[model samples]
Every structure is written in structure tokens, then in C-alpha cells.
Target chain A: MQRRLFLQGMLGVVAATRLPASTLLPLMLNGCQREPLLPGTLLSACDDARGNHFVASIQPDGSLGFQIPVPLRAHDSCASKQRDRALFFARRPGRQIYVVDLHERLLIQTIDAEPGRHFYGHGVISADGQWLFTTEQIYATGQGMIGVYRMSQPIRRETEFSSHGMDPHQLQWLSDGETLVIANGGILTHPDQNRENLNPDTMQPALTYVRVRDGALLESHQPPHHQMSLHHLDVSAQDQVVVGVQHQGALTDAVALVGSHRRGSDMQWWMADELTQLRMQQYTASVAVDANGGQAVVSCPRGNGIAVWDMQTGQLINMLDIADAAGVRRQPQQSGWVGTNGAGALVRIDSSGTATALQTLRQYPLRWDNHATLI
Target chain B: MKPRFVRKSRYEKKNRYVRKKMQLLLLIVALLSLAACNDDMTPGQRWLATTTEQIRQGYQQLSAQTRAQQQMADAFCQQPDAQGLQTMQAAWRESMASWQHMQWLRMGPIAQDNDDWKLQFWPDKKNILQRKMQDILEGSEPVSADSLVHASVVVQGFSAQELLLFDPQFATVEKFAGRQCDLLRASTTLTARVGQKLADAWQDETWLKRWVAPTATQAGLTPAHVRNGEILDALLAQIERIKNDKLGEPMGLKTRDKKPNGYFAESWRSENSLANLQNNLLAVQQLIRPAQGYGLFQYLKDSQQQALADEMVIKLDNAQQALQQIHPPLTSAVTDAAQQPALQNAHRALGELATFCKQKLAPALGLTLGFNSNDGD
Candidate 1:
């Protein structure tokens, strides 16, 4: 698949009609348009005007690679290393899941949650790419459950186990690839009650680690504030877990929104200075760690700003403004990270904290969702 | 000097002066003719003109209704009689329905200053208005226009007035005398003041100029296309809000249990939830395709999207018809078993209308709905 796309890209260069060889010579001599397109893919769920949801693959240079329509709105997606397929989870309280084959640019399978269960909009693929783990909720009991599926031609649900917490949202595989870290957003919601948080006052959010082999509870940690629902997370190569929180408390309260945690260690909450914290509005939509694992960035859609932090030092690096920005992902093999927003903007932030807008993809009409994964 | 040469030079100079004067006269005539034709106005400008006129008319109606409401409340306060109370209730309903007409114009001045919420604080999901009204009525918070300005927003708007006029506990003359009457008078007066201010704001000539000539502003709305796109987006947004939040929530189409929640309905206490929706749809229709003049529909037709415009008009008509079938007191219709089907049908019609506005109208107009804060988690 990669080879075919490469050949096609080369053909595009050779067949350029607007720029003749005479003009191309001067352009090449000036080293303009010389940067080649990045060699990787990024996947996101985009909503069209017709109410259809699509899992769209974007190339590194922000050009669209492929798009396959899904039955419902999708949130975060996980890519498989052993195959050319990716799993797109339905938005919270939705029951449908779609598996798409990027190589063929088609949906290969559809999985529906068992009765009385619904997805939390996030999932993770196992290291060997043989199994997929999804965070689900038993609506009747408000219990978090993990549904394991064997990744095969006709994907089969292998087994299920407790998530050891309630309302488990985004989860990631640990560096060891044997343990999974889940951000158990403690807000109690039932399908019967719609999207209302039923237990905001007494919510108990936690970050839990469990063994994928047997679903054993390895550890669990919670922030001091109960109303801070840890909903999104990304693990670094150094096994550092950076979590983004959504606050359910009063709007007047000032609380930390980004936290860093390591297994068996207390979760340390780091916040921007007082002004920046106030600007965050107590919500972090998405989080991403650089490829080197030394820095992390969080996108605050409410504040319209992205904050970069040194994961090791746990100090604020800088904050840059982008309107309605949410999705954040590390650029493949680069120290910088790329972010997308609801205003149809694609921006790149280098390791030095300089942000540049990639103008090519800014014209796409769809509002990018919460997470974009680099494949 | 020779007499013949001098005479010839003077005649040539006179001829040159007369020609310059004639040229200036022709230039002035041409300018006047161009101004008369109004050929500089684009389709978007024409649509904006119609929209602003409708907004101005809607706000003026609200002002009149609110002023009448205030006067009726004053009369009731002075008489303290059953007849006066009935008149006050009638006036309150009229004022509320008038306010509903202006709800769709949720941009510019109305959008600024939290005027929408100040005019009506809705979805009182937790009965905040009730709780706050009770507290203020029992406490010694001065019940005057000045005090109500800083009072809880929940207790200063239409919903608060609805409770005083319709709720069983506060409807009677004896139950609503003294401070309660004062609160009613004060709330109504505040609404009237706000309504007048809104109307006056729209009357500003500069605002109208800026709105109609969006490209002339420094907001970087460079081309007329960008300006038209924003107008289209705002129009569709109001329709979406009407279908999704105003109607869908009360009808239980958006709730989790799929069971009707009457308390979620707007103006439920006054049994005017459906009336509010009807007025909202009326505003939408008038703004899109006014009866006697050019509007968004005409703009689309001028842009060579006649089929899309025609389909939108049909969908909007269907929605209006469906709404007419539902009875008053939408609160009861949503929760009542027998009336559920009609409510569902009305919801479906409105949903289709909203879909057409979003999918068909937006794309044809080259408009995109920007990121709303409430779209996702």
C-alpha cells in the first residue's frame, strides 16, 4: 500500500501541468516547494453536513489520504501495527463501533455493544496488534467494563472484564505493552438519563492500571479534587502518563487541569500560572506527548489556547492561541506536534515553541474532533 | 498690438471655459443617475436590508408589548382587583410572544450584553427561577427596577414573570399584594426598558451600514462572499437551536430516557411553550422568505440556486403545518400519552427543516458552521 501511494505521488510530480520544465528549473534552484510530504498518516473522525460521520486519514502534509463513513459520530481511533486496519469508537453513549481498513479505504467490520452497554469514545489496540480493548459502561449499574476483541478477519469479542473504575474514557497501553492505563472519569451517567452527570457532587475520578492478560487491577490513583474528572490521557515512551481533566465543579473554582502520573507514584498536578489557568476554563479537550517523551501539549478548546509542558520538570513551557483547537498528536519522528481545531485549522508547533499554520488543510469544511492519532 | 489677433485669442479662451463648465455638469448628472439606480447593492446587501428591517420590526413589537405589560402591571398594582389581574396576565402573554419573535436574531446587539438570557432564562432544568423568586419574594431585596438590575437573572426575566402571573400560589390579588406586586411591576418595567434599548440599538444607521456593507469593515470580511456565508451560518444556527434545544428537549427527543419531561418545556408555567415555538418558526420563515419582499430565499434565487431555495421553502412550510396541529400547553402535550404522537410528528417536521437548512442551504451558500462550544466534550 505504501509503495503504491509513493508511486502515485511520483506520477503527480512528473505530470505537473501548471509548471512547465522551464519554470520548474528556477523553482527547484530557489529551493522552493522542496520540503517533501511527511511519511505517515493521521486519523480523525469528521462530521459532514449530512449528519454522516467519517473516519478520515490525513497525510503528514495535511492532505487527505482516505475517508470512510461511519454510522455515527466517532471520537478517538487506534491503529493496528500488524494490519492496515484501525478501530474507531463511537462517541459516548453510542453503541456502534467501526473498523476500517486504511489500505483498501473501506470499513471492514461493524461491532455493536451488548445490550445495556455503551462506548465511552475511546479504546486501545494491544501491542502485538492481535486484540483490541474498549472502555464501555453497563448503563444499568454505571460500572465500567472493558470489552476485548480478537483482531481477525471477522473480529470476535473474546472476553470482558471490569475497568476497576466508573466511566473509563481514554486508555493507553503502557510501555511494557502488558499493562493498560485508563482514565476513569468518575461522573455517573446513564443512557436513561441522557448526558447529565448524575453524581457530579460525589464523583470520585481515578487513573487505574490493569494487566491486559487477566484484567487484574495493578494500581489506581486519584487527584485530590473529586470533581476533576480525568477523561483523556497519553503515555510517553518513558512510561509517563499525562492526563487532561474536565472539571464538573463550579465555574468559579480554580483547579489544576493537567496532571502527570507514573505507576506506584502519586499523581502530580501541574497548572499554568494564575492568568493562564483562569483562561483554561477548567476543561482540557485533548493531550499529546512529543515523540521524545520529554514534552506534552494540551489543547483547551474553551480557552482557544494550547499549553506545552516539560514532562520531566513538570513546568509550563509556553502557551499559543488557536481558535477552537482540540485534537493534538505528535508528528512522526519529529520533536514537534500537530494540532487540529473546529475552525478547520491545522497547526504545527516545533520543539522551540514556534507555531506555524499549515495552510493547505485549512480549507477543509469539517470540524476536527477531539483526538487525531499519528499512524 | 493688432486688433484682429487680440479678438481671436479672447474668443478661444471663452470657448475653453464654457467647455469645462459643460463637462462638469455632465459628470454631476451621471453621478446622480448612478445613485438613483442603486446598482452598487448586491444580492447579499438586499438580503441584509430585509433582515435588518425584520429585526427592527420585531424589536419594536417587543418594545410595545413589554410597555403594555408594564402598564397593565401598574394598573393591577393600583386596583388590586380580579379584572385587573386578568388584564395583566393577557398583557404578559402578549409580551412573551413578542419576545419570542426576536429570539432568532441572536447576533449583533442582542447577542452582546447577555440580552437574550436577560430577556428569558430558559431550560430552568433545576427550577432555578422558582428557587430564586421564592427567596427574593420572602427576603427584603428591594423590588424595584434599580434593584432588579443586580438581582439574580433567573428572577428578573420572562420566566419569573410567568410564575407570578400563572403559578397558583401567586396569581391572586391577595397573594400578590405589596412586595409581590412590586416585584411584578419592577420585572415588567425592566423588560420594557431592555426591549426599548434593543430596538433603539438596531435603529443605529452606522450599524445598518456596516451590516449591509460587510466588506468595507476592518473585520477582514474581505469579499461579499464571506459576509454572506456568515449570514447564512447565523440563520441556520437559529434553526438548529429551535429544533434541537427549544423543541427537541421538551418533546423528549433529546432526553436519555426518551420519556417526555414537561418541566423541560419553555414557558410551561404559562402553558405557552408551543406558542413560543410557533412565534420562533414565524420569525425564521419571515427572515428566510418574507411575504412581500426579498429575503434569503430571493438571495439564493439570485445566486442561481433556485431549486435549493424552493425545497427549503417547502420544508419550512411543512414544519409550520406540523406545528399548527399540536395543541397549546406543549408542557402537557409532551407528557400526555395521547398527545405524544402529535408531538413526535412536529419534532420530525422541524428536524427535517433543520436538516435542509444545514445540509442543503449551507453548502450551496458556501457557509460552514463554526465550532460551537457545546458541540463535544
Candidate 2:
């Protein structure tokens, strides 16, 4: 092979059309900064807007590899528990899914998707690695749907069930066994963007459960707060669900709610939406259940702390301040989630909420790299 | 008498007045011509002075350029990025220690020719791996947020772009070819480091054994596992003697002028065919190979087993051919030509493999033993 070809294959190549010198200088300087690590290095991670191209990995000795760069625009990512792979989904305007081989570090394969008539949210892969499900925030032709992909084959099966309302932000299987209960945090959007002219009187944000074997959209329950953008979610071992809300403008609390399915309808709301939103700012990227799921963690990027929630009781257990933290990760072994505090050093958040010091990577402050590894 | 005198005086006076007016006109024409010539001379003098100044400025610019080039040369000799390549080369040796633990790179269950026959497999494996081991055989693809990308992005804004675009050379370096040049610069450093190693290896013939370490590890055997360490050590000694006698020894660089033979030149560019092939193999090998999960020997089907045996025989023949090709006078020349292509390829391919294994492959394997993930980025 020629040197150019070898280089093209070895590193990465982009179009080389010349730009003005002013445009190129900063990129040269930016190349000096190393990438940041995402949180939950082992359990797997996923986030909103199909930012799935973001992938992070870490060694047992604390060596961090952050944000697997993608050719296309990625909105969210989901790490798989059964394999050393990250599934990334592109955002609206495109439907290309990139699969990063955590072992190889290169982009192993890509699943071409057509977001032809819908917008997408964060997605998740099954523990068995058989199924991959994601929420279609807006379905132009049909009611809001959850698209299901069979990993072994190229075919896709969409569950055309009304999300009880509009946009479903995050999707996950609630329990391990036969029933497939998904936390469908609901809001409605235009088929292309998030500009949903929701009727304040009729609009409701819901959590819906589905039975996978039968493809039944069994039950739907709305959250008490209509304005909360309940987009991120994680399920615990005992079937408790931990959810984080990205409050829309004017809403006070960016809440974390814990509850389980009761009978058919969503019941026993021990943790209702807390009025925690200060100045209506914090954008919650992710929420995760620990290895045991006894405790849950939330990423408050604006506050620079991973707010811990007690699973048994619906209460804010503690807020691990990451103001000095650069890239804060929970579940460092499974989901290597990372955050930036406008600084260089990465603050590592282990699965147990123990924060530790990370190395100074680059000048650029870290951002959430969609999903982290589930080693 | 009075009439005659008046007529003569009047005639003489009229003649004198006509002569004086003609002389005054002549004087005015002369002054006009002189003024015209002086105006033309002003332009001529200005042109001559401007040309001289330009030439002087050009000479000074050329001098400055030469001085800058010299400074660049000096800095390039000791720059961190330059020395970094050498550090990477040395780091390669340490990386080999980890490869020794890998079972696949060890000696095959069936051994023939040399006891350390496993060492020869890397040359063969390089042929087989294609595209699959990219992560293992190559470093992580450059990330988007890298300095190269950011520098380019920064130029898109107004002020810097306008200023840089005005200067063609600086603009090209900044916008058009900055990132690529940076990468190439890094690669050149890496090449020099590897070249240094090759130079030392030429001095010591036992260098081939070290190069074969990865190949040996691929075969599932090691120096400790081999039956007699003493016999292998003696063979290494013999190899070393042949290498030393044939290649001579490195006497620093001071006595280079007196040496009869010169094995190295300033720069040599190859098709990189060998390096490319090795990279291909490493990429495939580094992937989640089905054979790797179990031992390569154990997973070998009946047909694969026969193929392995046949390949081993071919390798032995090649080794024999290599040994026979060695002659006292022609050894260095032949070795230079034969080894240059393969060594360059091997070193580069190994560098890629080491990086991939460390970055992506190991993490995928879930071997991260309490190491913090955030620090690596």
C-alpha cells in the first residue's frame, strides 16, 4: 500500500479542500488536547438527540479514552452489556448508526438508518444483545413509535403505539425477564425538530410499559409535572426506575423520580417531581442504576455534580460536587460517562459515587460523549 | 550736411534694436530646453534608486530565509516531537514484553527447524491479516477535537481568516495543510527513531531475533517454554558473531569517513509494501478473532492444520536460502537491501498494533482493572 493509503486507513481522513489559514490554526492547537472519558465505564450509557456517536473507554488502571469521533453527526449512544461495542445513532436530518468496536477503537461497522419521517431520542441495547430499541420522538405518518432492530439481521420492526402523547426521549427495558417495560418519558415534537406546539391543557409527559413478546403497549402513565422534559432514564435490579428531567424554559425543578409499575396503570408515585430547578438552567444528560441498583446517579452538567438518589426511598441522597471535576463518570467500569466543568482535569465518578482525580487531558473543557462503555 | 547725418544715425539705430530683440528670444528658448531636460532626469534618477533598494531588500530576505532554515534544522534535531518518535521506538520494545504473554503469538504445538521457530510467524501473519486488525495494527483514528481540527475550525471565523488568507504561504500552512503537515511531521520523527534502531541492528545481527519476538509470541511458545535455553542462547551467539563480522560495529560516527563501506544513505523511500502488508495482518489479528478465544492450534481444523504445516516448511526453506545467500564481502550490501523494506514495515506495523491493543482492544476485552477511565482522555 502507498503511504497515503496506509495513512488514510490507519488514522482518519477528511476532505482536504483548503481553508483560510485563520480557520486552520485553532484546529492545529485543538489537536493538542486529548479526549475526555464518559461515565459508567462498564454498565453502558445513552443520551438524548441521537448523540450516540459519542463513545468513551477506560482501563482498569484509570487510563481514559473519550469520545470515539464519528464522521457523521451523532445525537446519542448506548453501550451494550454483552459485547465490547457501542451503538451510536445519528440525530434528525439523518439516520446513520455507527458501531464502535471498543476493543479495536476504530469504527467497526455502520448501520444505515432513514429518519425519513421522524426524530429520534436516546436508545438502548438488550442485555442479551438480541434486540435494540429506540424512541422515535416524532413520527410524521404514524403515531409516535418505538423502532425495534434485530441485531442478527438487517430488518427493523417498529412498534406503532401512541406514546400516550408526543416525543419519547429515552427508552429502556424495565425488567430482566419476560416483560419489556420501557420508560417512555413522553413529549411531542414536530416530525423533524423539537418544536412541538403542545396544547398546555391536553399535553402530558408519560412513562409507558410494553410487553416485548407480544409487542403490546400495555400501560401509560403521565408525570405530575407537564413541563418537565423527562428524557433520560435507568432501571434498577429490583425493577425500580430512576429518571432525570431536563426542564423546559420556565420550569423550576429538574427532578429525579423513582417508581415502579403498579398493576396496569403507573401508580405509587412515592417520588413526585421536586421543584429543584434553580433559574431553570441545568441540562441533565444521563441517569444510571448502580451495579446493585441500590443507589442511582444523575449528571447535572450546569451544577457540576452527580446528584445521587436513594432507590428505596424517593429522596435526594447526596450531591457529589464536581465543580472542580472536568470529566465526571459514574460506573467507571461499565458506563464511562464524562462531563466538563470548563476546565482541563477530568473528575472520575465511580459506580459507588466516589469521585477521584483524573489527568489533565487538553485545553478544551469536556462534554458528555453520548454513551460510555459497558465492559 | 545735417540731413545726411540724421538719415545715417536713424538707420544704424533701427538695425541695433532688431539685433537685440533676436538675441533676447534666443536666450529664452535655451532656458526652456534646459528646464525640460531636468524634469526628465528626475524620473530617471528615481527609477534607478528604487530598483537598487528592491535588490538590496531581496538579498536580505534570502539571507533571513537561510538563517531560518538553519534554525529549523537545529530545532528539528532536538524537538520533543522529534525525540518523541525515538521514545516511541523504545516504547515498542517494552510493548513486546506484553506480547510474550499472549498465547497466540507463541510457538505452534508442532515445531521444526529452530526451537524458537515461533519467532518467524510474524512475517507470515503479516501476509494473512488484512483490514480486520486495523485497531490493533493502527493507532486510534484522530479524534475530531484534536488540535489539528480545532486550529482549522478557528480559521473559519472572520478576523484570523482574513489576516491569514492574505499571506499565501502562512495561509496554506495554517488552513490548507496544517493538520496533515503536523501528522507527517510526527511520522517523520517516528521514522527517524526506527531508523536509529535499524542502524544499531545492522551493527548487531541478533536484531532479527528481537524483530521475531512478536512472530514467536504468535506461535504460542516463548524462550522460557523452549526445551533448552542454553542451546537457543548459543544459536543467538552464533547469529551475533555472523552479524558482527559481516556488518562491522558502530564506532560512533567519528570514524565514518575512514570506513570502506557505507550501509546507510540520507533518505530512502520505498513503496511501503511490507509495512502495509504487516499492518493489514496486525489489524485482522487484533480483532476479536474466533481462533484467539481458544488456542490457534486447538481451533485449527483439519485443513488449517495441513496449511500450517506446509507454511512452516516453506519458512524453513526461506531461512535456509537466507543463510546461503550470506557471503563475507557481499553480506552487508545484501542484508541492507533485504532487511530495509521489511524492518521499516515491521516497526511501523508494530507501533500501530501496540497503540490499538492499548487503546481499543484491551478495553473491549474488559481487562481494565480499577484504572480510571477519565484520565486517559
Candidate 1 residue-wise lDDT, B220-247, digit = tens: 2223444455556565666777777777
B173 in model 1: Cα distance from truth in Å? 2.5
- Scanning candidate 1 chain B in windows of ten residues, the lowest lDDT window is B214-223
* Candidate 1 C-alpha error for residue A231, in Å: 4.8
With candidate 1 superimposed using the best TM-score fit, by how many Å does residue B338's alpha carbon deviate from the native? 5.3
Q: Show the colliding residue pairs in model 1.
A: none
* Interface C-alpha RMSD after superposing true interface residues, each candidate, one decimal: 7.1, 24.8
Put down candidate 2 lDDT per residue, B58-95, tens digits, no spaces. 22332333233323323443443534433422332222
| Tens digits of lDDT, candidate 1, A237-282 | 8899999988876433557999999887898989776446655667
Model 2, chain A: how large is the TM-score? 0.67
Error of 2 at A352 (Å): 7.6
